[model samples]
Target: MNMNKKELPSLLLLPGLLCNERLWQNQVNNLVDICQPFVADFSQDDSIEAMARRVLDRAPEQFFLAGLSMGGYVAFEIMRQAPERVTRLALFDTMARLDEPERAATRKGLLRLAEEGRFIGVTPRLLPNLIHKDKLNTPVADEVMKMAAELGKEVFLKQQTAILNRSDSIPTLSKIKQPTIIVVGEDDKLTPPEESVNMAKAIPNAQLHRIPKCGHLPPLEYPQLTTELLRDWILQEA
Candidate 1:
């Protein structure tokens, strides 16, 4: 493998909805020894295709890729557009199907709240759904809220729009040959564990990991474990 004088392959981390570089800050800092990490700016576009293009424009020629939640949607789109560029894949708390009617309606309601200026960031009603119930008041939970709040309205709308219009990626799954890992929280109310399992099953040579006591935001709730898992995933095919 061409290391470009770097010790390990480049790893591109795509954050979920309303997330920023801070989303992968931990992994970036922790995995520095094994990978040259870059976190994508997902706020620059309103469609998954556009977002993938932007990220691809800046990413290394080839890299390991990871996406969580909404990022997973964008990941699938990226894989659709450039399967050859991806060396491996890591999907966390994500799904390959188009949004369910109920979930789409819920997203519309949240977007409505944002439009009405009622709640710019993720609101209290939605916070509990994001983290494990026991961790609702933890620092990690606060950080997630802070990230959402700081990203604010424009970003929220753009991401939600991208997610709402994202294609059902199941058709593309069978074609993914990269070494992949699907990670999810056991208590994730948003995407749940079964989705990760199903996604792992759909992708060729994919692994599945369930973080106990975690919720939608596993990176925040289990930063060290998540980072470690990601590091291992990167090395699997290296």
Candidate 2:
């Protein structure tokens, strides 16, 4: 099942907050030649567990799974439900910790705003925190704004509320024995490198990699690194 072989494992990419399939466009295109990659849809589900179930319901019998930010939370739930089904794991710019009280409170506030038809505020206020200081002024900011626009107010509220209530999966990482990769952007502010370090240490057989000059949305900010690491990790496990 190594890279030396031709039949690579299927890869399922889960996007971060307020994102859809467009988030993984670069990864999809870059890795399509090496392996089959599908972007999981979570807009229909309002809870992390339910989202995981929805994705699993449509996933192949067995394959590699990867996710970012909130999607990382769902990926862990998938691991909990169908550990035997995952051949490999990759988590990018995500944390293994549960929502602390302060974080939960912030999420709730954002959820409330979204519920009140404030999707516009969510993007501007939140996007800066996700990326590095320099990126806040670049085209990346415009891109993020455009993506958030696609999510709409209703989806924003649902996703934010779901993140506010997500369960702690730090303890579950140790139980996962598959070849796992923990990726973090060097410039990500939302989920710091410390978070990825903790996740790498907790997950069995996991390796951590950093994408320089990238932010929380590495799949979009540095798609080449994301695709290369994902491809390498899945192939190494095979």
- Among these predictions, the greatest lDDT belongs to 1
> Candidate 2 on 128-208: residue-level lDDT in tens?
677766677677777778877887787777788788778889889889888888999988878889999988888866899
Predicted structure 2, TM vs. truth: 0.91
Candidate 1 C-alpha lDDT tens digits along 172-199: 9999988889999999998989888888
Q: How many backbone clashes can be found in candidate 1?
A: 0
lDDT of 1 at 66: 93
Clashing pairs in model 2, backbone N/Cα/C closer than 3 A: 1-238, 2-238
In order, candidate lDDTs are: 0.87, 0.81
How well does model 2 score by local distance difference test? 0.81
**Each prediction's TM-score versus the true structure:** 0.95, 0.91
lDDT score, candidate 2, position 24 = 87
